[model samples]
Target chain A: MDVLSLPFIQHAILAGILASVACGIIGSLVVVNRSVFLAGGIAHAAYGGVGLAFFLSLPPLPCIIGFSLFMALIMAAFTVERRHRMDTFIGVLWAVGMATGIILIDLSPGYNVDLMSFLFGSILTVPVSDIKVMAAVDILIIGAMCGFYKEFLAMSYDMEFARVRGLPVRLFHFLFMALVALAVVMTIRVVGLILVMALFTIAPYLTERFSASLAGMMVTSTIANIVFVFTGLWISYRYNLTSGATIILVAALFFMIFIILSRFASCPRKP
Target chain B: MAPGGDQQTTVLPEGQSRAGEVPDVEIENCSFAFNSVPVLRDVNIRIYHGDFVAIIGPNGGGKTTLVKLMLGLLKPQKGRVRLLGSDPAKSCRRVGYMPQYSTGEKGFPITVMDVALLGRLGLTGIGCRFTREDREAALGALRLVGMEKYMNKRIGDLSGGQIQRTLLARALISNPEVLFLDEPMASIDIDGQSMLFDLLGELNKKMTILFVTHDVGLLSRYIKSIICVNETVYFHHEPKISPDMASLMMGTGEKCPVEMVAHGIPHRVLGRHERD
Candidate 1:
C-alpha cells in the first residue's frame, strides 16, 4: 500500500499499463504474422537509437523512436522483393545496428551511464516525461490499428488477396514496421530491449489457445499482460528483485503451466 | 470473333453501349516478366460479362501471370489492362480472388467468419465497425459454400475441403462482378470439386469468372471458353474442343498455332508438352 502511494511506483504502474496496450495489439500481429524474428531484430537494433540519443545528448524518447523507425523502414524495404534471402539481410542489420550502438556509446564524451537498465529495463526509474511519451505512443498505435484494422487483418491472412482487392499491401507493410518500431521503443522502458520480445510474444501466444480471431487474441492478451505486470511488480517489490526479469519470469511460469495443463487436457487418456 | 486471329480489340466507344454489355475485363498486348526471364508476352484477352472462362496451361506457362496482370497484382511491362471499364487496380473492389491453396498459411489462428469478412474490407476504409450488413453478407457467403455452421470455427480446425469452401466464401462475400480463382481444386476431393464448379457455374450467370488451373480436362465441361497461355496466349472463344484440337492440347502432336484451332486446324502436330 505504501509502495502504491510512491510517485515512482505509480509511474511504473502507468508505464506497465501502456506497455501492455502495445504488447497486446502489436504483439498479437507479430505472433500471427510469424514475424517474431523480424520483430526481434528490430527490437535489438533499437539499441542503436539509445546509443545515438546518448551521444547526441538528445531526449532519449524521440531520438530512439526516430532511429528505430528508420531501421524498421530499411528492414521493410529489404524484405519486400527478396523474401527468401531476408534472413541474411535482417541478420546483417541486427549486427550492424548493435555494433553502431556500442561504438557510439564508447565514443560519447563522459557518458558512463549504467547500461544494464537500458538493456534489462528500469521501470522504477521511468520518469513522468517518459510516461507521457509512452502514452502518446500508445494512442498513436491504437489509433492507427483501429483505422487500418481490416487492411491489416486481410494482409495478415492473405497478402496476395489483399493486394488484388486493391489494398495497399506494401504501404501497409511499411506502416506496420514503423508501428513495430514505435512499440519496441516505448516498451524498452518497461521490459528493456533484451526481454521485450518475450513480453510481446508470450501474451498473444498464450491467448491463442482460446481466441478465435485476431481481435479476441488481442483482448485476451491485454488482460493477461495486465495480470502479469501487476503480479510481477508485487512479487519484485516483496523480494527486492529486478522488476523486468521478475515480470518475464512470471509470464514464463504461466506459459509452462498452461503448456502442461493443455497437453494433458488435449490427450487426457494418454499415459 | 475476329476473322484473322492476329489481334482483336473490341473496346466499345465510351458511352455508346450499355454498362451491362461492356466487357468485364480486357487486356491488350500485355507482356510480363520476372527478373530477366519473360513469363508472358503479347497476350490479349477479353472476358465479357457472365462468361465462365478457364485459363489453362502447362506449369510455368504464365497462366498465373496473366491472372495477376488482369487482377492488377502485377503490372505488365507493356500493355493495357482494364476491369469493369477502368484500370484493374482501381476497380479491384469489384473483383474477387481465391489464390492457390498453397499460398494460405496452415495452422494460422483465424476463424472462418473473420476470413469471410475479409471480403467486406473494401466497403469502408479503416475505423468503422463491422456492420450488421457485413456480418449478414459474410454469413450468406458461408452458407453458399455450405460452411455456415463452421463460421465460428477456427480455420485450422477445418478439413482441407472445408478450408477451401471457407476461402470461397471469403471471395464471394464481396459480391464482385468478376471472380478470379487460381488452382482452387488442389486440395478438394472430387465431390467437393464438382460442387465447387457447380457453384461457380451458377455464379457465372451474374458475374464473370476467370479460373486458372492446369487441370483443363476436369474443368472443360463447366467452363464456356478457354485461354491457353504459354509465353504467349491463345484465346479460344468456344469450349467445344474439336477432336484434333483436343489431341493437340493433350500433347499428342506437333504444336499447331492456336489460331489454327479457331479456324478448322489442318493436321499439324503440337510439340510434346507435359502436364503439371
Candidate 2:
C-alpha cells in the first residue's frame, strides 16, 4: 500500500497537518511575543496532564488537554507575576510542575500509561476523538487569531505603546496565552510535551528567516509547518522509526541548515 | 513666570484652563532601589496641565528610571506618584508612554500602523469591539506623524527616523491627558529630530508633555521646564526662561560628575543615589 493509502498513515499525516496549523498560528504569535521560551516551559509542564488523565482512568485526550490548559494558565499567570524575576520563578515552577506529574504517575497503580509517548509522542495512535478535538482547537485558535489580529499585532510590535493606545494589553496577553494553551494541548500528541516547543517555534523561525512582513511570516510559517510535519512523518514511517523523535530530528536538521545558510548570506557581501 | 516659583507659567490655549485642573504628574519624595542598590533618592516633582518638560541625566543617572516612576511602570520604594491625580501604576490606560527607541529590536514583525495602534489598547475593554471612530482616530494619529502612507508597512522596513515617528503616533493615539516620551529623538537624523520637536510642540498645545532625552541644549529650546535626574531628582523651573542656569541647575552638587564618553551626557549627571 502507498504511504497515504494506509489508514494509520493517513491518520498520522492528518494529525501532523492539524498540529502544524495550530502550532504555526500559535507559533507565529509566540515568535512575535517572544514567548518561545515560555512555550518550552509550559509544554514540559503539561506532563502532569498526561499523568492525571491516565491515573483518573479518564479519556487521555480530553484529560491531557484539560490538564495542559490548567498548567498553561498557571505558567502564564506566573510569567506575569514574576515578570521582574522571570527566569528564577519560571525555573522553579517548571521543576515543580514536572515533579508533580512524575509523582502522580508513580502513585497511580497498574495502569502502564505509556508515559514515554508524551516524551517523544505517538501521532500514529491519534484517535478519531483526538482528531476532532484538534480540529476544534484549530478553529478556536484561528478564530481568536483572526479576531485579535490587529490588537495582537499592536501588542507584539510594542506592548507599552499598545497600552498607551488604550488596548487592554493584560487581557490580550491572557487571551494570547489561552490560545497558546490550546495549541500546546493539541500538539501534545504530535511532538509529545517535551519536543512540542520545537514544532511551535521552528516553523515560524524559518518563515521569519525568509519573510519580510508579519503576514508573510505567518502564511509562510503555516506552509513550512505542513511541509516539515509531512516530510518528517514520511521519513519516519518509511523507515519504521520512532515518529516523534524522527520528526524533531528532521526539524532540527532544517533549523541548523537554514541558520548556517542565513549566517553566511547575512555576512558582508564582497564589495 | 509663576510669582514664587522661578518658572514661567506653562502656556496653554484659551479653553485649556487649569479648571477641572488635572495635574498630569505629581511625584513627592519618591525613592527607588534596584536589587538593594539605591537608584533614585527622594525624588519630588509636580508637572501641571500642558507643561512641556524634559528629563535629562546620565546613563546610570536614573532618567529612564524616573520616567518609569511617573508612568507607573515602576513603583517607588518610598513616596508617591500621581498622574491626573491618580496613581500611575493603577491608571495605566490613561497614560501615554513612548519608551526609548534606541534599544528596540527590528526582527519582531509588526507594521508601522500596528505599532501606532498599541496606543489604542487602553481605549477598549476586555474583548471590546473597536468602532469605526477608533480606527479613524488611529488613522488620524498616523496622518499627523506623516506616516499615513506607510500604514501597512512593516515596522522593521522603516528607517530609524520613521520608527520614532511610528512610536510617537502610538503614544498619541491613546488621546492621553499627559504624554511621556523617553528619548524620542534618539537614532534619528537631524530632520527627524526637528520633525519630532515640531510634532511635540503641536501636541504640547493640547496635553501635558514630559520627554526624556540625553541631549540637554536642544530640549530646553522647546520645553518650558527640565527635571535633571541622576541618583536624585532636581527641578529646573522654566529651563528655557533662564537659559544661563542650564549649567548651574545641572551641576546640582558634587554628587554627579560629567561622564566623558563618545555620546556624553548633555548636562552634569549629578545627585547622590541613596544606598540600600
Candidate 3:
C-alpha cells in the first residue's frame, strides 16, 4: 500500500494500464491477421528509432514512431506485393534494424545511455512525458478501432473477399501495419522492444478460443493484459525483479496453464 | 446441350432479357504474369448477364488467377478487364466472390453470423454498426446455405464443408448480380455438392454465376458455358467437354480441331487431379 502511494509506482501502474490498451486492441488484430511475425519485426526494428533518437539528440518517442512507421510501410509493401518472399524480407529488416541500432548507439559519443532499459524496459522509471505519449497512443488506437472495426474484421478474416467487396484491402493492410508500429513503440515503454511481442500476442492467443468475435477477443485480451500487468507488477515489486520480464512471464504462465488445461479438457475419456 | 459443337447460341433463361446487351463481365486481351512467368496471355472473355460459367483447368494453369483478375484482386500485366460494364475495382461492390476455402489463421475469432454480416460491408457506411435489417439478411443468407443452426458457432470450429457453406453465405448475402466462386466444391461431400449446385441453379435465374473448379464431372444442368484455362483462355459455349478438349485442358494436347457433340447428363472422361 505504501508502494502504491509512491509517485513512481503510480506512474508505472498507469504506464502498464495504458500499454495494455494498445496491447489488447492491436494485439487482437495482430493475432487474428496472423501477423505476429510482422509485428515482431516492427518491434525489433523500432530499436533503430531509439538509437537514432539518442544519436541525433532528438526525442525518442517521435523518432521511434517515425522510424517504426517507415519499417512498417516497407514490410506492408513486401507483404502485399511479394508475399512468398515476405518472411525473408522481414528477417533481413529485423537483423538490419537491430544492427543499425547497436551501431548508432555505439557511435554516439559521451551519451552513456542505458541500453538495457530499451531492451528490457524501465517501467519503474517511465517518465510522466512517456506516460502522456502512451495515453495519446491509446486514444488513437481506440479511435481507429471504433471507426474501422468492421472493415478490419472483414479484412482480417478473408482479405480477398474484403477486396471483392471493395473494402480497400491494401489500404487497410498498410493502415494496420502503421498501427502495429505505433503499438510496438508504445509497448516498448512497458515491456521493452525485446519482450513486446509477448505482450502483443499471448493475451490475444489465449482469448481467441473463447471469443466468438474479433471485438470480443480484443476486449477480453485487453482485460487479460491488464490482469497480467497488475499481477506482474505486484510480483516484481515484491521480489525486486525485472518488471518487463516479470510481466511477460506472468502472461506465459497463464498461456501454459490454459493450454495444458484445454488439452486435458479436450482429451477423450473412456466410458 | 452439346459438347465441342459450334459455339452454342446464347439461351436466356425465362424472364431474363439482358443477354447480348452490355456484357456483365468483359476482359479484352488481358495478359497477366508472375515473376516474368506468364499465367494468362491475351485472355479475352465476354460473359453475358444470367450466364452460368465454369472456369476449369489444371493446377498452376491459372484457374484461380483468372477469377482473381475478374475480381480485381490482381491486375493484368496487359489488357482491360470490365465487370458489370465498369472496371472491376470500381464495380466490385456489385459482384460476389467466394475465394477457394483456405485454412487461414487457425482459430481466427469470427462467428458464422459475423462472417455472413461481412457481406453487407460494402453496402454499409464505414464506422456504422450492422443494422437489424443487416442481421436479418445475414440470417436469411445463412438459412440459404443451411448454416442457420450454426450462426453462433465460431468459424474455426466448423467442418470443412460447413466453412465453405458459411463463405458461400457471405458471398450471397450482398445479392450481387454476378457471383464468382473459386474451388468452392473442393471440401463439400457429393450430396452437399449436388445440393449446392441446385441452390446455384435457383440463383442463376437472377444472377450470373462464374465458379472455378477442378471437378468438371460435376458440371450440372445450370452451367451454360465452360472456360478452359491453361496459360491461355478458351471459351467453350457448351457445358460438356470432349476428350480432346479435356486433354487440351489437361495441357497434354495441341488445340483440337474437331467439334464432337455429346448431349445430356454431363460427364467427364478425365480423372480427378490433385487440387492446389
Candidate 4:
C-alpha cells in the first residue's frame, strides 16, 4: 500500500491517465480511419528526432516532437494517394527512421544513453516534468477531438462523402497527423516506441466490439487503457518484471479474450 | 414509419422546373484522365431541377468519374462543372452524396444514428457540436428511411439492405437540393432494389436526384431520363431506351442488348431502335 504513496508510483499512474486520453481518443480515429500503419511509421520514425537531439546536444522531447510531426506529414502525403501501397511505403520509412536513430546515437560522442529505456519505456521512473508534458498533450488531443468530432466522424466513415460535403478534409487530415505525432512523442516515456502502438490500438480495437459510437469507443478505450496500465504497473512492481512489456502483454491478452468472446456473442443482424 | 407524413418535405419554390431557372447540374466540355488515360472526354450534360436521372455505363467507363466531377471530388482536365449554378466545389455543401455501399467498413462500431448524422456535417460546421435542430433533422431522415428503430443500433449489426438505407438517411439528412448516388444498387437484392428505387422516387418529387447504376432495365420506372456514359456522354431525354441505344451505350460487343424490363411499367417501353 505504501507503493501507492511513493511519488514515482503516483506520477506513473497520473501519466497513464493522461496518456490514455490521447490513446483512447486519437486511437479510435486511427483505427477506424485505417491509419494504424501510418501511425506506426511515425512512432518508429520519431526515433530519428531523438537521435538528432542527442547528437546536437538539444532537448530530446521538443526535437523528437518536431521531427515526428514532420515525418507524420510526409506519411500523410504518401497515404493520401496510392493507399493500396501505403503499408509498403510506411514500412520503408519505419526501417529508415529507426536505422537513422541508431546510427546517430552511435555517432554521438561520449553519450552513453540508456537506449533500452527509450525503446521499451521506464514509466516507473518518469519525472514530474514529463508528466506535465503528457498532461498538455492530453489537453491538445481532447480539444482537437471535441472541436472536430463531426469532421473526423464523417471522414473516417466515408471520405468521399465528406469531400462532397465540403468538410475541408485535407486541412483536418494535416492537423490530425500533427496531433498523432504529438501523442506518439508524449507517450514515449510511458510505453516507449516499441510498445506504443500496442497501447494505441489494443484498447480501441477491444472497445470497438461493444461501442456503438465514436465518442463511446473513445471513452471506453480510455478506461480500458488506464486499467491495462495500472494492472501492468502492479504486476511489474510485485514481480520485478519489465513494466512496458508487462503492460503490452496485458493488453494483448485482453485483446485476444475480446476477440474470442466476440465470436461466441450473438451474430449481428445482417441487412 | 410514416415519416413523410409527419415531416413535410422542404419545398424550394424555385427548384420545381428546369425552364427559366439555373440548372441543378451543368457540365460543359468537361474532360478527365488518370495518368494520361482519358476516362471522360468532352462530357456535356445539364440536369434540371426535380429530375430523377440515372447514369448508366460499363465497369470502367467513367461513370464514377463523371459523378465525381459533378460532386467536385475530381477536377476535369478541361472545361467546367457547375452545381446549383456555381462551381461544384463552391456549392458542395448544399448537395448530398450516397457513395456505393462497398465504401463502408462493415466491422466499424459506429451507430446508425451517428452515420446518419454525419450527413449534417456540411450544415453544422466542422469541429462543432450538432445543434438540436441538426439532431432533429437527422432523426427525421432516419424516420424517412424507416430505420428510426435501428438508430441506436450499431451499424455493424445491420443487414446489407439496412446499411444501404442508413446510408441513404445520412445522405438525406442534409436536405440537399441535389442528391448524387453512386451505385446504390450494387449489393441489394431485387426486392430491396425496387424498394430503394421507390424511396428514391418519393424523394425525387422534392429534389433533383442523380444515381449511377449498371442495372438499366429495372430503373426506367424510377428515372425521368438517362445519361449514358462510356468514355463519352449522351443524355436521353426520355425514359424509354431502345435496345440499339442500350447496346450502343453499353458497348459490350453484343449485337442485341439484354432487355429485362420490369413487367408493370407499360407506359414506358424499350424495343429495337429501328432507325439506328
Candidate 5:
C-alpha cells in the first residue's frame, strides 16, 4: 500500500482519536493529582519494559505494558507507603528506573533497538491491533474515572482531610493508581512513553485554569487534546515535522493562548 | 453525630490500680526519639473524658510528636499511645484531628464545599458517595465553624481565618468522639484565636479536646487541665495562670528559672514555651 493511501491515512486518523481519548482522560487526572511528574517517572521506567521485551524475544507491547504497570505501581506505592520522607525515595526511584532502562537496553546483546522512537515517537506505523488495545484501555479509563469521579476529585485535593471525613482515601489512591498505570500503558503507543508526560499534563492544565468543576475540566481537556493531537498530526504531515514533537508544540501553543485569554478576560467568578 | 459526654468510656482499661490511665487517653512509658535526640522521653500521662487538656511547651518539645503519636502517625520507641479504648490506629475513625497554621498549606483548585465533604467521603460507603445524610452532616460542620457561606468558594482563595475554619470543619465533620487540634489558631489574627477559644470551650459539651500549643496563656482561659512537655512529660497541672504560667505562655520569660514542678518532672521553661 502507498504511504499516502486513504485507508492507511484513515487508520492513522482513527488511531489519533483513540490516542487523544486515552491521553486526555488520564492527563486530566494526572494534572489534578499533581502526578504529572509521576508520569515522567513511569515513562523513563518503561524503557525497562522495552529492553526486557528485546532481551527475552517477547512481544514488545505486552512486555512493555507489564513492566510499565509494574513501575507505575511501585512508584504509586512509594508515595502512599513511605509517607514521611517520600520525596527522597521517589527521587531515587526515578533515577533508578531510568538507569535500569538504559542499562538493560545496553545489555540486550547485538540487537540495535531504536532508542529514538522511544525518546521522540513514531506513530506512523501504529498497528491496528495496538489501536484496538488503546480503544479498550480508553473505555476502561473513562468508565472507571467517571464511576469514581467524585471520590478521586475529593482525594486529589487533600488525602488526610478526605480520610478524616471518611472518604476511603487509601482505596481510591489504589484505584487511581490502577487507572494511571493503565492510562500510561495505553499512552505509550501514541506519543511514546517518553513524551506522554507532556501530553498528559499540558492538556488538562490548560483546561483546569478555566474550568469551574472537575467534570468540566475533563471535558475541556478531551476536546483540547483532540485538537492538540490532530493539529500535531497535520503539522507533522504538512511540514514533515516529528509527530511527537509537533504534538507537544501544539499543546504548548494552546496553553499559552489560554493563559493570554484568561488574562484579558475578567476575573472568574467564585462558585 | 454529636457524641455526648463519656465518649472514652469504652477505652477504659480492665486492670486495677494503674495510676496513669485516664478515661480518655493513656500513654504508658511513651518514649520517642528521632535520631539520638529525644523528642519525647519515657512519658506517661492520662486525660479524662470531657476535659479540655492543653499540651503547652517550647518548640521542639515534642508537642507535635505527641499529637502524631495520638493520631497513630508515629509509633513510640518504648510505650503505647491509646485513644478512646483502642490503639490510635484502630480508633482513628473516632478521633477528629486539626493541624495548626492551615493558611500555609497551599490548597489546589478545589471548592470549599468539596473539601468539607471530604470528611464524609470514606465513611459513607465503599466508594464513599455522599448521601443526603452525609451532605447534611458536612453542611452542619461548616455552619458550626462559620464557613457555610464560603462552602462554594475555592479553597485557595480563602482568608487565613476562613481557611482555618475550613480545616476545623474537615476535622469536626466526622463527629469524632475525641478532637485534637495542633496549633489550630496559630495563623489566625488575635481576635480569631480568641473567638476559636470560645468556640472550643462551647465544644467541650460532648467531646474531649487536646490542643497542642507553645503558649498556654492564650489557651489558659478555657482549658480544664494542662500537660507540659520539654522532652519529658508533665501531666494534669492545675489550670491556673500564675505569674510563672503567664510568663511561660507569653514566652517572654520563657526560659526563666522558676519552672512549675509538675508530675515529678522538671521542665525547661524555654523548652516548654517556645516564643514562635
Candidate 6:
C-alpha cells in the first residue's frame, strides 16, 4: 500500500491509464479492421526511431513518432495498393526496423542504452515528461475518433460501400495507420514493443464479442485494460517481477479464461 | 444478345418510359483487367432511369466487376463510366450500393441502425454527428426493408436474410437515384428472395435498380432488362432470353443452343440445350 504513495508508482499508474486510452480506442479499430499484424509491425518498426534518437542525440519521443509515422505510411500504401502482399511486406519491415534500431544504437559512440527496458518496458521508471506526451497523444486520439467515428466505422465495416458512399476510404486508411503509430509509440513506455500486441488486441478482442457497438467495445476494453494494468502492477510489485511481462501474462490469462467461459456458456444454450 | 452491339430490342416497362431522358448510368467502351488479365472487355451499357436490371453471369464472370465500375470502385482501363451525367466517382453521392454479402466479418460489432445510418456519411460532415433527421431517415429505410423492429439489434446477430435486408436499408437510407445491389439474393431463402423482389419491384418505381445475381431462375416480373456478363458484356433489354441469347450467355456460341419458354409472369422454362 505504501508503494502506491511513491511518486514513481503513481507515475506508472498514470502511464498505464494513458496507454489504455490509446489501446482501447485504437485497439478496437485495429482488431475490427483486422490490422493487428500491421499494428505489430508498426510497433516493432518504431524501434528504428528509438535507435535514430540515440544515434542523433535527439528526443526519443518525437523521433519515435516521426519514424513510426513514416513506417505506417509505407505500410498503409502497401496495404491499400497491393493488399495481397501486405503480410509479407509487414514481416520484412518489422525485421528491418528492429535491425536498423539495433545497428543505430550500436553505432552511437559511448552511449549504452538499456536495451531490455526498450524491448520489455520499465513502466516503474516512467518520467513525468513521458506521461505528458502520452496524455497529449490520448487527447489527439480521442479527438480524431470523435471527429470520424462514423467514417471509421463505415470504413472498417465495408470499405467498398464506404468508397461508394463518397467516404475517402484510402485517406482514412492512412490516417488510421498514423493513429496506430502514435498509440504504439506511447504504449512502448508501458509494455514495450514486444508485448504491445497483447495490450492492443486481447482486451478489445474479448470485449468485441459482447459489446453491441464500436463505442461500447472501446469503453469496455479501456476499463478491462485498466483492470489488467492495476492487477499486473500489483502482482509485479508484490513479487518483484518484470512489470511488462507480468502485464502481458495477466492479459493472456484473462483471454484464455474468457474464451473457455464463453465456449462453455454458449454450449449449454445451443440446440 | 451479341457482345458489343447497340441493338435496341428493349420493351420498356409499363408506365415507366423515359424515351428521351439521359441514362442514369452509362459505360462507354469500358474495359477492365486485373493483373493484365481482362475481366470486362469493351463493355457498354446504358441504364435508363426507373429501369430494373438483373446482372447475371458465372462465378468468375464480370458481373460484380461491372457493378464496381458503375460505383467507381474500379477504373476501366480503356473507357469511362458515368453515373447521373458525371464521372461515377463524382456522382457517387447520388448512388446507393449494396455489396455482396461477405461472411468474413460476421462477428463485427455494429447495430442495424448504425449500419443503416452509414448511408448518410456523404451528407454528414466531418466532426459532425448524425442528426435527428438522419436517425429518422435510417429508421424509415429499415422499416422499408422490414428490419425496423430489429434496429437496435447487433448486425452480427442477424440471420443471412436479415443481414441482407439491413444492408439494403443502408443502401436505401441515402434516397439515391440509382441503387446497385450485388448478389442480394445469395443467402436468402426462396420465400425471402420473392419477398425481397417484391420490395425491389416497389422501389423500382422510385429509383433505378440494378442487381447482380447468379440465380437466373429468380428474375422478377419487375426486371425490365438483363445484363449478361462474361469476359464481354451483353445487354438484353427484354426480360425474355432467346435461344441464341442463352447460348451466347453460356459462352458456347451456336454449338449449344438453349431454348427458353415463358410460362407466366416471372416464370420461364429453359428447354434442354442441344450440344454438338
Name the candidate that leads on TM-score.
6
Worst 10 residues of 5 chain A by lDDT: A159-168
Interface DockQ of each model: 0.46, 0.43, 0.64, 0.64, 0.36, 0.74
Cα lDDT of model 3 by residue, B190-217, tens digit: 8898899999999999999999976556
Question: Which runs of model 3 end up more than 4 angstroms from their true locations?
Answer: A269-271, B1-20, B251-276
Which 10-residue window in model 3 chain B sums to the lowest lDDT?
Answer: B8-17
lDDT tens string, model 6, B10-39? 322222336787789988888998889899
Error of 2 at A156 (Å): 2.6
lDDT tens string, model 5, B1-276? 121222222111121234655567878988998866788887887777788888887776788988888777778989888878787767777878886653334446567777677676557665436788878888999999899998888776778778878888988888777899988876677777777878898888989999987754465457776676666665644454333433333343434332244322122232332221
lDDT of 6 by residue, A138-207 (tens): 9999999898898999999988888888888889999999999999998898998789999999999999
Q: How do the residues A121-237 of candidate 5 rate in per-residue lDDT, one tens digit apiece?
A: 767767788778878888888888767877777777666545544555667776777677777766666677667887788888777756656777777788887898888988898
Model 2 interface RMSD over true interface Cα atoms: 3.7
Please, what are the lDDT tens digits per residue for candidate 2 over residues B114-137? 566556675665455566777788
- Superior candidate under lDDT, 1 versus 2: 1
lDDT of 1 by residue, B99-158 (tens): 878634665678899889888887856556678899999999999999999988888778
Which model is ahead, 1 or 6, in terms of lDDT? 6
TM-score head-to-head 2 vs 6, winner: 6
Q: What does the lDDT read for residue B274 in candidate 1?
A: 26
Q: Which lDDT tens digits does candidate 1 get at residues A87-170?
A: 888988988889999999998988566577789999999999999989999899889877778888888888888877777788
Model 1, docking class: acceptable
Score chain B of candidate 4 by TM-score: 0.84
How do these models rank on lDDT, best leading?
Answer: 6, 3, 4, 1, 2, 5
- What is each predicted model's overall lDDT from 0 to 1? 0.80, 0.73, 0.85, 0.82, 0.71, 0.86
Is candidate 3 or 5 superior in DockQ?
Answer: 3
Clashes of 5: 15
Candidate No. with top lDDT: 6
lDDT of 4 by residue, A180-270 (tens): 8998887788889999999999998888878888889999999999999999999999999999999999999998988787777746844
Clashing residue pairs in candidate 4 are A147-B127, A270-B159, A271-B158, A271-B159, A271-B160
Candidate 4, which segments miss by more than 4 Å at Cα?
A81-84, A266-271, B1-21, B189-192, B249-269, B272-276
User: Of the candidates numbered 1 and 4, which has the greater lDDT value?
Assistant: 4
